[model samples]
Target: MAGFLLILSLFIAPLGLSQEKVETIVNKLPERPWAVVEFVRGKVLFNGAKVLKGEKLRVDGSLEVSKRSFVKVKINGWDNTIVLGPRSAMELKLSAQKTGDISPAKYSLVKGACRWVRKKIEGQVEKGLGAVHTPNAAMGVRGTDFYLKVNPLLGETEIIVFDGEVEFTNELEVTDKKSLTSGQWGGVGGRYGQKIGEILNLSKAVLDKFGKKLNI
Candidate 1:
């Protein structure tokens, strides 16, 4: 009986240690309202504090990327990644209506450019997934990879879609909206007046140019 009990303890000891290792990993993960900074280049700041790679950042404040700088973040509970380009400033007002649902995420791009890429979620339809609000325009995304450049001086927003679909609407005239798909481009405000610009094809050269800029 003593030898049998010793054998049983040997088998159970490793299992107990494995369980504790798993729990420690789970506890190290970032909680809600915080995101992981996956990449950073040049000077990046989150709410006035310098940002570093591999650190968890609270997304409740503003993010600024100085000239010749870039920052990439993965938000918790969201199936997407956001990259802010050089000279960009964005306010992260992100949330979900329900747990594990692709509810709308609200973010404002104050100036410069940003890129949003959504990973396909299994068994999830491509509609009403998220939204990005700029000064003059609002964009509704559906499992898409898109880029936005906000020209604050001219009050214009340029949107380019590389994959999936985006619904663009003028902030001043919500009735004026357009649906754009892959390889298409749209604009709001400035010369577009109270309506969104006519949807146009995105040339390969233009696509490559912006794609490289956003590091997509």
Candidate 2:
């Protein structure tokens, strides 16, 4: 009878813990944030180089990557940028836009920074998501390759286009997307995004890199 009681208590103890665990998780969901930011389905190494998949990121969720830990973002989506000191945080504000299939609202990834590569123009550009905000300016992208950087302490953003082009509008009129190609880049400071310029030549080195199957 003593042995039977021991076994029963063991099971009951775990069951009790499970309920408390569920309650804690449920309580966190609301005070935590409305949604989550799902990273690509791949392996991400932490400070010691370990590939991880299905990272559940909430607002202010952070994953620290040191020199020893390098991350490889695999798979598809509008996920083209990397975060600096990437708190691994999934900003609740952008969670919906990142999770939703389609929308007009834009999403911005601030801090650290990332460079982007655009896929063929097959989706809605306006409702599409693209933009990395930094302290000095913001980098806007549509169907092109661009880089963005943001420092947490400083309030600034900067952008550089490797291929294609971006629209730059600020204190003065900058280049339009219609004038970018290979070996060309641009930078902007201040509240940027919304729209960028275009590359006039489509049959150039930059566009060729994408290897799109022309309907012709």
Candidate 3:
């Protein structure tokens, strides 16, 4: 019996040591910020308080841009950037998966317009960098530069892809989706059973107008 007990103790010792090593490694892991504010123009509020340049933003944070104001934020580690246009409100959320890996930066646009530009890193995959959810639609990024606008009152969302591609789907019906590429535009309406509109070529005039609005 004493020999059996000694054997059991020996077997348990490595398990405890392994657990301690794991805890030590986890504790030593560095904490990373979710995003950082790179620029601010006019009046901008983060979580109901005024925002300042170089501020670090965490998950579950909110941003509101007053009329004629703009704010620019860069996702830490990912190098992706988001710019909010006037009268825009957006919320940031983290994915359950680990950051800088399979996890994609998630955002919910409550209203107004915003632009997203994904920085292309050499040898990095172009997709799964970020996603945006609007009232009427959802967009999956593929290393793209795009502009999105939401009209809360009308329950509508407009999307224009300047470069790369965006996978757009109707929030109401996931099956109703389309891939928008450069020079393409689409939209979704919030009415009952509303679906994503047909993909259309964006005229240069429309691009100019949107560029002015987004200040891209």
TM-score of each: 0.78, 0.42, 0.82
TM-score of 3: 0.82
Sliding window of 10 residues with minimal summed lDDT for model 2? 83-92
Q: Write the per-residue lDDT of candidate 1 for residues 79-124, one digit (tens) a residue.
A: 6788999999998765545323333457889999999888778896
* Every model: Cα RMSD to truth: 9.4, 11.8, 7.6
Against the reference, the lDDT scores of all candidates come to: 0.79, 0.40, 0.80
Q: Which candidate has the top score in lDDT?
A: 3
What value does the lDDT take at residue 3 in candidate 1? 69
Record all residue pairs in model 3 with backbone atoms less than 3 Å apart, i.e. clashing.
Answer: none
Best TM-score goes to which candidate? 3
In TM-score terms, candidate 1 sits at 0.78
Q: How accurate is candidate 3 locally (lDDT)?
A: 0.80
lDDT of 2 by residue, 1-216 (tens): 356445555666766655455545434442212222234333333323443544433332233444322332322344343422233211213333332343222234444545456554556554335443333344455667655454445444444555565654332333433334444544433343423433233345653553331101
RMSD to native, candidate 2: 11.8
Global Cα lDDT for candidate 1: 0.79
Misplaced by over 4 Å in model 2 are 1-51, 54-64, 72-93, 96-110, 121-127, 151-156, 169-182, 188-216
Where model 1 places Cα greater than 4 Å from the true spot, the runs are: 1-33, 95-104, 126-129
